[model samples]
Target: MTGTELVIDGVTLTAGAHCLVEDVSLTARPGEVIGLVGPNGSGKSSLLRAVYRALRPATGRVGVDGADAWSLPVRQLARTVAAVVQESGAEFDLSVREVVAMGRTPHKRLLDGDTAEDAELIRSALAVVDATDLAHRSFDRLSGGERQRVLIARALVQQPSLLVLDEPTNHLDIRHQLDVLGTLRRLSATVLVALHDLNLAAYYCDRLYVMRDGKVTASGPPAEVLTPHLLARVYGVASEVIVHPRTGAPQVTFLPGAPALATRVEADPSAS
Candidate 1:
């Protein structure tokens, strides 16, 4: 399947009585990569959850291929969208291959078994991430970085038209981070990924949305959004936005000072 557009319109996500993210609207064009960037407790993850339908929006709609995500059946939605989340359940004792194979579940009919095609797709996914040799390893036993790559492979096998990932580079080293982002660059899917690395987001994403205090303060191409003034206003930091010599994307280098956020060390987890 080819890529399809993803739209989150007038979305408000809440946790308990607190509004985590309010009235956010964004779009990921077909086969385009969009970045979500913000400080911790800025509601990046909360907004992503609503896109994948793991969390329902308090008000607004998430549209995939011009259809309402909330109106679609869960199974149908899964087939169209796949997600790689931070801190997936820790108790599963499955092997790397088993975890990857689960990506096919959305496609299988009830009481049906895996087809030979499914096996090939699973193997292909592992190869794409260079995790083919680790197929027999216990998933729970892998290092955090290894587990991240495996989870990405699982999403790859899903063959989704729209892929949602929350901090997909969480545990990766610099090399793996580049490798993984390169992989996303080659995929024929609409991608909305939450990233803490501003440089990487600028390098990989076609457009970006900067969230601040549960709202999007800016959204545009990296060049327009990564200005020093915006950084100071939203991230409460001092930085210089420079043109990358190679990619021409915006690069931010921190100045010698602490950010100005009040209560930087600890924030209400519910707001995030």
Candidate 2:
């Protein structure tokens, strides 16, 4: 399946009277990996929710392949956009395989059972995320990293053209983090991911959208967007951005003074 183009135009989201996202706009061309990087409360997750139809924008539009996302039917939207968010609702006693099977729901009739192709997709997804061994375990019993990988497998089985993942590496260890992010980079689908680790964002993303205070502060290739000045200004961290000789990707090396600077900024709210 071909990747879908994603466009967020002038979108604004609110929680009661407090704005969560304000006029945030960005684009992911077909088959591109776009990263959203920023500190906590930067609205990256909120913007992603709009794309996957979790939240309706107060102002502007979320477009998938030129069609307005809000105008699509629930099932249609689910087929086109798959999401793995940070917050998962209670799974009760469902098994890992049972949870992943839910992804096929959007494609099946009410009473239809899993077809051969569906079974193959589920198996392949589990393998991709290295969760095949946990297929029979109860979802509630899995570790946080294990659960996260399973959720990603569920999204993969959906066969979406566009995938939106918020903090996909949250509970993962170093090896699994690299494994998961590497899998995403190899995927043919358009990917929009929110990442906290600047180094990971720099390596995996084809282009990046840096968010601060609910808006995009910078958007460009990793090398251009992950500069020392931008890091200090947006995250209040002192750092150096260098190119990795082997991978040719930008790598961030934080200075010792970064934490103290961040602490000072936090102490004085007006400093930011």
**TM-score, each model?**
0.93, 0.93
Q: Per-residue lDDT tens digits of candidate 1, residues 101-209?
A: 9999999988788899999999999988888899999999998989999999999989999999999999899988998999998899989999999999999999999
Model 2: how far is 21 from its true place, Å? 1.0
Relative to the true structure, candidate 1 reaches a TM of 0.93
Per-residue alpha-carbon lDDT of candidate 2 for residues 1-272, written as tens digits (9 for 90 to 100): 46999999999999999999999989999999999999899999999999998899999999999999999999998899999999985664899999999998999999999999999999999999999999999999999999999999999999999999999999999998999999999889999999999899999999999999999999999988887788888988777666776677887877878544321111222333
Give model 1 RMSD, 1 decimal: 7.2
Quote the lDDT for 126 in model 2. 94
Count backbone clashes in candidate 2: 0
- lDDT, candidate 2, residue 42? 92
Q: What is the lDDT of residue 78 in candidate 2?
A: 89
